[model samples]
Target chain A: MTKYQRIYQELLDKIKTKEYKTGDYLPSENELMKTYGSSRDTIRKALQLLLQNGYIQKVVGKGSVVLDSERIAFPVSGISSFKELKESMDGTIETIVEEFTVVPADDKLKDELHMDDGNVYIIERVRSINGEKIILDKDYLNGNIIQGLTKQHAQDSIYEYIENELNLNISFSRKEITVIPATKHDKEVLDMLDYDLLVCVKSYSYLEDATLFEYTISKHRPDKFRFVDFARRSQ
Target chain B: MTKYQRIYQELLDKIKTKEYKTGDYLPSENELMKTYGSSRDTIRKALQLLLQNGYIQKVVGKGSVVLDSERIAFPVSGISSFKELKESMDGTIETIVEEFTVVPADDKLKDELHMDDGNVYIIERVRSINGEKIILDKDYLNGNIIQGLTKQHAQDSIYEYIENELNLNISFSRKEITVIPATKHDKEVLDMLDYDLLVCVKSYSYLEDATLFEYTISKHRPDKFRFVDFARRSQ
Candidate 1:
């Protein structure tokens, strides 16, 4: 690892261990430089990384202060799998596969998935947390790339299968969040009643090589949907 | 600027200028290396920065594909000011100040803002783009740090005043997005009659000194609210 990366990781570990609690100020630049035996620039670079990662916030007069880590709820800021998201949260989550089929890409699918002409696998699932249905996920994956998707894989974690079984590198994603009126499909699948609004998340998942492999529309019940993000000022 | 930053900026300029139009593949690493007289690793670093900033998506077999930049509408992924947001969009925008007052922090406000016994300046405004009322901004700024708030500042841009006049470095923010049933305040102030749902964005903005300086609740008409984010996998 790079020097700055090592420093950043060490500081992050300190924050995670509660050695540097929330509202506590970190060591000053001079102190960190002395302890790490590094230059001010190097120390600042490490601090910048920590700031970007939402571990600490730099104060003008004071030093970097540890932010309340508990405040980050349902981190939708980064490209993460459902399994990873479940691991981060506290609850027994279950995925129920509603439908799994391979179909030719229609005009709407072509426009939405940005694919010219191909067959795509459509997987419908309802995710529940502690027996409460919250999300209805409809995924359209490129059949050419993601082959042999079965109902068993859908019931489990498709992302895990894609990564472990297929050995495909899930690289990045472009996500758009909006609120829309709940449709009949959403109401039926999510078991949502009297919830007029659904938080819709449309995502385009890309492979490591930058191929857009999957398009998903996740409809979430309004009360159950909350997206949290940590953002820095773009300089 | 560093070599990688310079290269990233140059490539971004090319994309913006349509020298590398949308759907066009960027030059290969070898070609970029030859042109820039840089190492392969250095070129890759430049390309990685471009990918992070959403200028280009690297396709495995197809090199880097220029994504349609116009598809990103009103980016809520980052912590940006209203003035900055307006500058990025087209059409005339106006802000109507509804209320401006200085009030002592209540129990809820104190806890939410992370402030002790202190006063706060509450400002409410309605934002219109292309003569369409879309956003309702309710900002509660710490009176100690952010002082001298007036109706003019609310009508203009309070963020601009905070940065320019107050000379405070706005650092970061934690944002939470959810859909809620429109309240009476939202209906009356935002001139909403038929709209049932509102996209609610609650944000806590901190200064460079790691002090929570402001708390804002931005409510938007469901149809008009959209958030776009470009995210990479955490390896």
Candidate 2:
């Protein structure tokens, strides 16, 4: 393997083993060059490969820090509150909410979202991995969950606003996931390029009172999606 | 919707809500005709739809029972014991262990399976869903896990055979899953009818003693493959 490739694997292994965790600043190029005995160009190329693979990110003045892609992954088991997950992950992960509006809830959605009657707030978002859009979430929340919703609030993580601003306790939830042929709407929303199927993660979140807070439908590119679990024989 | 469609949905809802669990025999066809106030043909059509959609199964002498497809699913937090999961739910989820042979362990396999310059037994099998081949699994087990291994011993769940037959504690695991363009071997093993990408689930299973018992590579056709999770925000 090439010197650069070897460095890349070494760095990846370090990250996987949590030797370098999310939000931890990596050594500068000059320092890496000195330590690895590599040329400047070789060091830059290796860093670039890691950056492109969602391993690390660079800031304008600040040095490169590990990205939190693995930190917020929703393992396939029970549901996760996106807000709580981000907060516990140290709040470094950011959200760019794109759209929010109140619309008439349809029959299917009414049942799924558990809306009593009337208009519901629909929030749309593009979740990013170090600034690159990865998850396109479209949520239907009961209007009663929050009275006033704004475009600005929608741009960030809704979970943040829900708990930090609205003070709602996200207790538990369930999810049903399925694979479907990509619809034209999914392509437009998710900007999927090469994948044929769209993995749909449909989940319902509830408040501590057991009232449904939001029902979300997430469309992810098949290539970038993974759901992992550990299992054993039940004695 | 037709009467049969309505009946199908009603039964599906019952199954989803656990009114009818896996292995619970459904009411007889004549009984269903009375309950739904529908003709025998309508009831039959509803049952047929359920079978096709993997909701229920029919036994030769016994009546139809709900099929627990979700019961044996991989858990998000822990490893799933396929044998225990199958036993928890009704119906015989059979595993046909096809091939068992020993080969020199590769460097990567050695690292993952915790082997050191030793022979590794490779086990290959096609897991069927109600007699229809669905999953193609290839496992590299440490020769030390099962002292004596032959093709016949692996015909059922290897984990079961290892634990009950040989007494090994299959414990926690880590996994990495990805979607890749189907290879020629994938097509042959999965018997792919259509050209599409395959979702690969790869994991290393560990014993309680921390010895890696198996390294698995399972491939599934996208349509039949699903990984579902309900994640709550980290506390």
Candidate 3:
């Protein structure tokens, strides 16, 4: 499964079956190296893994264009997981786990979980989908490196028991985002009406040995948030 | 300026003079290879240019940490320019230019500017900082690859006249972000009475030959937005 991951899974199944739609273009690294007999550095490594997974956008003399695959609606530009953003959306998600404790680290949670003194855990949650709500999260962790968390690991999936039962490794994050104004605990947990904004986000995470260990926030519901991203310009 | 850009400008001036504050750490790479007699791959290429400029966050066995130098508020996570984000804040920044023109492309501006049916330009503007009106923008471009745009290049700096008088090379973007509710041309241009959210963004850009040319949107005013970012975990 590697001739540039089989031409990046046959151009991501012909761009999810729209048969290469959104502004078309693709097909010319010498016509995808003579239709996949390959090599123009394996069709530019399958168009640089479809331009790093946002599914195509190269464009210069115009080659790999096709973007707008619903521009990944609520993707929050990487470091995913909430069961991989609820299996990339369709509905019926849920979640709930309202609060799980441990506490102790104040001083703004020890400078927002850079952690130095002690005790941590916290949690919260809410989420939901085809039945409204729309995110809330909260988290915190780093109680001496995430120990014994339960409440069925925050009703299943505390990043899948912190990477499959504490093997750890999670890696990076740093987010931020903003918007604010709806608290009263987001007007009592979620389905906000007359929505006076909320978005928020925050984040921090880490740990592929560079441990900073979680620190979330989440929030959303400002018309059910969205993010996407991609960037590059830094020559 | 080399020797890892003079140790990344003396650790970005000791993290903007908090004398290495926010979550501290730094120092070791054999103590900056014995205080700069250098090597340890030039202090890990000056801490990978302070973790690619968000200033610092390494942390594995815990080394380069010091982040939160006001984690770049309203930075809109890169692909900058509104005069490089009003020369990174502390502000007077204005702009105005309400609407420029050119037109034609319709059909949702030729699939949101992937363009194939000529004529484009557009523009619009607003911005501001010390004098209030948070932001608005609009843009579009690609009139056969951005030609003679004026209104004094939309009140000075249409990406510095597309990279110094149309030499053109801009490069990357994709963005998205969201929020909405506030248009009446954002409550008649900007300070939305006690804000009913706005944020927006959208984007597209491209160019160092991979041309898409442009497409924008912008918006803001959700408490003058903020974005940040920095991700990584794709393993």
Candidate 4:
């Protein structure tokens, strides 16, 4: 492998072994170059790859620091709803519910929510990190879950009230993410249309006994969304 | 809602309910115009929305046929890999394992695969449907599952060989899909460079005892890939 590649692999190995945890600082460019016996350009290239892959992030003066590893953790398994996950996260995160209503689920909605036998509660909202809108959440809830949900409740974390207040046991979730165009509604919900692309994450959540609890379709601004996975060799 | 939206929703409702199944034809423009009592331009607008969302596909001389719903029906309780799912779909598919090697499972990799100990086998591949490259797969397998795999054998379906030849029972998989730009290698593997967009899919498979057997990552040329999911609302 080339010198840069070698260094990249070594750094990856170190990160994997937990030599550096999320938010941990790494050596300066000069130090990394000195240790790896490489030039600044080569070292920068390696760092660029990690940044592009969402592994490490750089601050203006702080140099490079590990990101929150959980940000790109494995695709959720089993029953946790996006609503539930959002609720469970730190309270600093906020949501601006854009639309919520009782609409007959379309075939796409029916197929996604598995609502072949009934109506669906469609809720659309945007999630904010700090104060910036980063994710647009479009969810379909069984009318059975919340009989009379309104737009007022959607403005906050719905999952919080469902589990903490209503006392429902939220368990596992299956999710998928894809890219799509930014629709007019997306522009309105996010309050900005500077970007042209959106990353869509679709998820299905189930209860403790394996009963489906929530079906959510979310869209994130492409530049803001990152996904990560851990993999091993099969025998 | 606009008159056009009303027409669009009505048509969408029909397709969602399987009032039109795959390969089933819809009424012509003139027929729809009369039924919805709208002008030609208004009717066209409604039809355009359906086409944009992939609900119906229009043919040149034959008109429009209800497109197959792209939502996939995944057996949530079963322990099957994408390899097995394609195989059961029969010889209509082919796979080319591009690269395979034993790699150290890093913290991110360990976390994603839940591999707290030991090494992993990393496998990369492309899957084709009827000779068209549709999915690019990158996987990490548990070393204990397939200890002595050569790169040559990895070229074929590893899951099939594991179950039919090795006698290891492959059971359940948790998967996620997303969209990404084509990497330099993606161009070489998918054999395209002009289109920099790709759809990425990842799945984590488990053995009968819940041991993660494999972590598979796949990418596809977006225009050519359509995902199907059978979703259910949380109860």
Per-candidate alpha-carbon RMSD to the true structure: 3.7, 18.5, 22.8, 21.8
Model 4, TM vs. native:
0.50
Instruction: Judge the docking of candidate 4 as incorrect, acceptable, medium or high.
Output: incorrect
What is the fnat value (0 to 1) for candidate 3?
0.72
The DockQ for candidate 2, computed on C-alphas, is 0.18
Candidate 1 chain A, run of 10 with poorest lDDT: A72-81
Give the candidates in order of DockQ, highest first: 1, 3, 2, 4
Better of 3 and 4 by TM-score: 4
DockQ of each: 0.60, 0.18, 0.26, 0.02
User: What are the TM values for chain B, all candidates?
Assistant: 0.81, 0.61, 0.33, 0.58
Looking at candidate 4 chain A, the ten consecutive residues that score lowest on lDDT are A226-235
Model 4 residue A71 CA deviation (Å) reads 12
- Which candidate model has the greater lDDT, 2 or 4? 2
Summarize candidate 2's per-residue lDDT along A1-235 as a digit string, tens digits. 7898878888878887889987788888889899899998788768866764446766546677776546324344334445544554432455666677898778876887667677788887876555545577888888766667677767655667877788887755556666678877666666577665877777777665446778888877877676654333222
TM-scores for every candidate against the unseen true structure:
0.86, 0.62, 0.33, 0.50
User: Against the true structure, candidate 4 has what lDDT?
Assistant: 0.66
Off by over 4 Å in 1: A1-10, A24-49, A58-64, B1-10, B23-49, B57-66, B90-92, B130-132
Instruction: Provide i-RMS per model in Å.
Output: 2.6, 14.0, 12.6, 16.3
Per residue, candidate 3 scores C-alpha lDDT tens digits across B49-153 of 677656676766757787775755537676888888778678787889888989789898888776778899888888889899888888888788888887897
| Candidate 3 residue-wise lDDT, A147-166, digit = tens | 89888888878888888888
Cα deviation of B68 in candidate 3 (Å)? 18
